[model samples]
Target: MSCGMFDESRDVIEYHPIPLWITPFFFAGSYMKKRIGKTSIAEHKKTLLPSDEVPNYFSQNNLFARLTYLVFWYLYVMLETPRIILYSLKKKPDLFYGYEVYGARVASIAGRILRKPVVTRFQGTPLKINEQRNWNTLYPHGVLGLKSKADAVIMANDGTHGDAILERLGAPKEKIFFWHNGIDINFVINTQHGEELEKRYDLNKKTVLLSVSKLVLWKRVDRAVWALSALKTDYGVNNAFLFVVGDGTERAYIESLAVKYDVSDSIHFAGAVPHEKLWTYFTLADIFVILQDVGNLSNQVFEALSFGLPIVSLDDGSTTGILKNQYNALLIKKQNIETDVPRALAMLIKNKKMREGLASRAKETFASSVCTWEERMEREQKLLNTLINNEHKTSY
Candidate 1:
């Protein structure tokens, strides 16, 4: 049977998205001790909920994952589908909720069996109708037009992308809503330092630039190497060093790029740090930079803002203008990254006053515009309660 904490007081059962559980870019601990039963469940004023993870693939092992999926995922789903059904039968949850495709599909199957409402949070880009849905074989329901099975669908990150906006994902227009995940920063979460990291790196003396993300091909971290080189070659800012925080398939290429650009000495390759401890690097950074394929506004963006670091990122309208030039961040156009990244980094490094100004504004923007997890989840809870009530009336 599925594992979850039943809240009799609230009449709700939640499969809380285990903190970046599947995000290999963050930490392997998401799959390790960070999971529920392993860690002590702290009491919350609100009801405590149980969470679980169903990993799709390993980080930095995409191609290998695809090849092994035939052998692994089939057996994986085979075992899970039955447990999900049995869990639903045993728990008789008022409703079922899911995190991503795998969890969502399993929840859908359980809901169909129990005739309960299912709400799913789907963040990945939508697949075309004609495109083969590989996940079809993984679950019992085939998962074609899964949105139809879900009572409510939550699309991550503003949901304005072509697939989501055009309804190409086949989600009923009415069932859809948008909610970006919120950060948990009340008073600058990282007030401590990583001692070993401090001894190993010359972060205190050097002008530190930080970039945290999966070093995937699409993220284009190679361009950050180019900027790091520019800080030396073009701008002649020899004291500056770029600390890259992540590990992925592109790690080799990025390492090679650092050597190619002759800035190998100036870049620190701190492979994936534990999520809770990442704030150590954040507190140590002077500026945050990224050349993401999508617009800026990932978890790192908020973390940087909270840490009061000025941001230099590329925006492609994918996030619908979450960042503004010179107001909260320095936004680079996709077409101008070759010029924009170096220029932005150079400018921030040269002018401490402006850098501090932007950093201040970024912190202010986060305080004024952003919602914490408590606030966002409160809204989500209200929605779930409303949906349950509406379905109850409909049944009557």
Candidate 2:
């Protein structure tokens, strides 16, 4: 939305998700059989969005939950697809841009029904999205069908990441675009929250280990908590403190793991930190950790890079070619993650010199390699404008 290339109210009709029901126990995603319609501008932008506030009530990896989710989603798409077609007919917008799996499917169906062009973006690695548990929105064959229908498909990568999934999906080579996710580098470099975080957490005296991600199985935040336990038990690193910086359906499971591992006292759940103030935790940490299962080099990883914290992550398919081990990050193999993650954390905790060295390398690498949000905005504007202006353009 910061890309403000087009006025949202007139030119675009994007999805703006909001809670259908909110309480201490049941959240928006948990309110099944609830879908409301609203149009409003996000606080940061003046763009009007067609809010399809739907219930995403299930986030569990179980046979019953999956079946229930399918039922709810089918009901939602069946009801919502007509409204989208009606809106498209009334507005007659030039393009239909659908985000992620479900949105893309809905848009593709509606676009086909109306004989309109559609553009869809793959938010994560599309092939094995099924393994993400409740985070999975579509099956491989379902996405394969969506890819074939879309006029253009956007993948969030700098072209260094492989395109085997696209090849497997049979997405048109000519219609593919590579636009990696970028960050506000200057904001992170310039912002400082001072000593309050340090004083509150006593970070100066502790080996502060930070993991910033939604508490999801795909994100593998539970691995970080287990590593914290291993540090104290196996390595005698009792002063280590782990700060987990996001919450989700997997939060209770992770909390249970912390208790099971006996690291609850040393673990601090910061929940969801506001974007503007998130720098405080970033700046107050000694080492950063994330074990993204599908090798998604996401925003939190970029934020960790900007903070110049030594990172501990997996050297997987996506990150292998991008993040070099030791020079920029300390990467471990996935086969032995339970053992390797904890051992890697222990190594970082014991060696302060190594931590400082890796931190310096990370900052230097980020300065040269990463693109800022402004640059991303420019690229997106150019591509989208071309897509809109030319009705006969072949490939970009």
Candidate 3:
């Protein structure tokens, strides 16, 4: 089953093509459906009512919101519950899949009731929410109830998230899987670099250190700038430049920090650019550095790897999975909230062997282990087939 809001993209595709780019890139995968479950009908039994949307504020703290979400989720499963009983129940699809944790948890119960499988994909900060937060006890400890019921879990980050699942959710070993979000490597690398970008930023033949992401608190982009500044002062890195990509709430603050540090000329904020044009930054950049503290994985890091650029990043949850100490990346740390990112970059520039070795290994990792659109489909199809076939054999 899928969440109803996911289909919201169809409305965008119909209304505005330009805005459709904002839709989640993976929504195209909705076409590949096995079977979804539904909740029980206490009312008309024969009719399954279509669900409605609830606002974000309602979901924030109200007890009714929690109960309604749980019940409607079960209702969703009731619409598809029969699919598990009969192997031929493929004429109509099952319940809708919800994208959030609350909806996914309720759907897990529906999966157990209907003997159908459920899988939840993680995209944001892994396991950080399991601690004693404002809404801590709404679900089970570490959200184990959902994990126990779910057939499998899909982690967008690396295997580092496996700990959060096991410790907080109490998920079994066999139930967890990893999917490194990747992009079109060759297509991105082959794109023509915009000459204007090079000339405007004075990045011609300069060893460019790139940071392409939203300007936000946890991203710690200031660390990258700090490193670049140090590289220039300590190592006489006159040939180096920093290309900052994307715009966000913290744009003004970041720019102000650049000026305060007296490295404004060395740093250039390119702002938000189209996806096609984003590749040019990679094409022109010599290295990429990301220091996200929350999410275990990022699209920017994948793009960097796809373009065969060496990465320098902090050892946070996002990079802890794929970024080994010295293999695929130059992993640094934040000492008392002050990162040694500059030291990491300085070492890389001094040792060309380490830089080339990291780029080579990252490319290999993307080709063999990272998941692409084709690979995701095949793996998902195989899992669904196995789940469906097992049900058939049990019935016989």
Candidate 4:
């Protein structure tokens, strides 16, 4: 089971080569499924999870409300556990794989009953905000046991998240594996959406700066707006424009910041473009900026690299391990967001040769390293096969 939103209309499951049986906690329905054509994965009956339609005053800060919310989800998982166990018994799956913390707990329970090895992939720091807040604690008695119970705990990145698992969850070192996210290079290279967007947005002859991610507060999209203002005012980058793709709760706030900075005209908020159609925006970009507070490796960074776009990001765990300063990309110190982000952007905007050099090296790095979706899946498949074959059972 995966916790991520699986909207068939916007997201394409075909990119994932593995033959999956997805049981998403939240799904957009059969109408969208039919539109996307036959998916590579089989869809299971959607889980009856609690909806996020709480009253206005029912806030996360309220202790009673938080506990009630947690209890409701725990009960929901318990209700679904029987179905999971029965399904495992009937299908006899080689292994049980869960995507997030909630799925991990459910799969772990089912795995123990069936005595099958369980693998849980933590897409982000487990028990972090916006998801389960107490996943580290064991359910019912509220003890710490989820990480210890899993046969193997996979992390999407080996940066901040991996460190959190080791230090916070106390996960065994050997039990952890880092599977960096990968991109569809062939799709990125071949897919093309014509100048319809470019013409509509008046992108021609403008130095295009792109940032693609959900418009969330932690993402610090306001920083992009500030940088745009800095570029024009301090750096004399009049022809440059920042295109922010993706939407979230912070849309109005971000727009307000743009107005305050007087870069509203320069910063184009291209709200939530379809995932399949993102290649067009990628093709249209000259440089990519990711102003996330924690610089974990993002899918947008991989997509930008696949298109050979020069990237400007902060020097932190999110980008440090993957991007090298003055090599594939430029990494600014976090303290220097005000001085350095604009400086870096201005430098890239003015220096055509430097931009091409960084972009070229970035593409080369992705091509030579583990950057393709097929390679990522291959590693995961091998790991699953190893666990199923019971080879080096005690090693993990």
Q: Specify the highest-lDDT model's number.
A: 4
Question: Residue 23 in model 1: shift from native, Å?
Answer: 19
| Candidate 2 residue lDDT tens string, 1-396 | 000012233665455231242132233334432332211112312221111111212322234434444554555556656776776677666666666655666666766676656677665453443233423343432343345356677777732242455654566677777666878765542144537666676777898888888765556676787778877877888889888899886788778878988989888888988776677778778898877655547777777878788998887656654467988788877777767777888888888899889998888877877779898768766766676676663321
User: Which rank order by lDDT, best down to worst?
Assistant: 4, 2, 1, 3
Candidate 1, 284-395: lDDT as tens digits: 7899886665435677787788878888876666545456788767877777766767888888888999999998888887787678889888988887777666645221
Where model 3 places Cα greater than 4 Å from the true spot, the runs are 1-98, 124-126, 129-148, 158-163, 186-193, 316-321, 336-339, 392-396
**Who wins the TM-score comparison?**
4
In candidate 1, how many Å is residue 271 off? 1.3
Cα lDDT of model 3 by residue, 1-396, tens digit: 233211122322111111233134223222221111222122421221111111112222244434444454454345433432242233122322323454455445544544455555454323444343533334322243244355666555542354455435466656665566555554543244577767777776667888998875446576676666677777776677888998886688678767866789888888997777788888887788876655535777777777778888766545754667688887665442243566677777777788889889888866666667677767855664565445431110
**TM of each candidate vs. truth:** 0.73, 0.74, 0.69, 0.77
Cα lDDT for residue 95, candidate 1: 72
Inter-residue clash pairs, candidate 1:
none
Off by over 4 Å in 1: 1-87, 126-148, 158-166, 186-205, 392-396
Worst 10-residue lDDT window for candidate 1 reads 45-54
Q: Candidate 1 or 3, higher TM-score?
A: 1
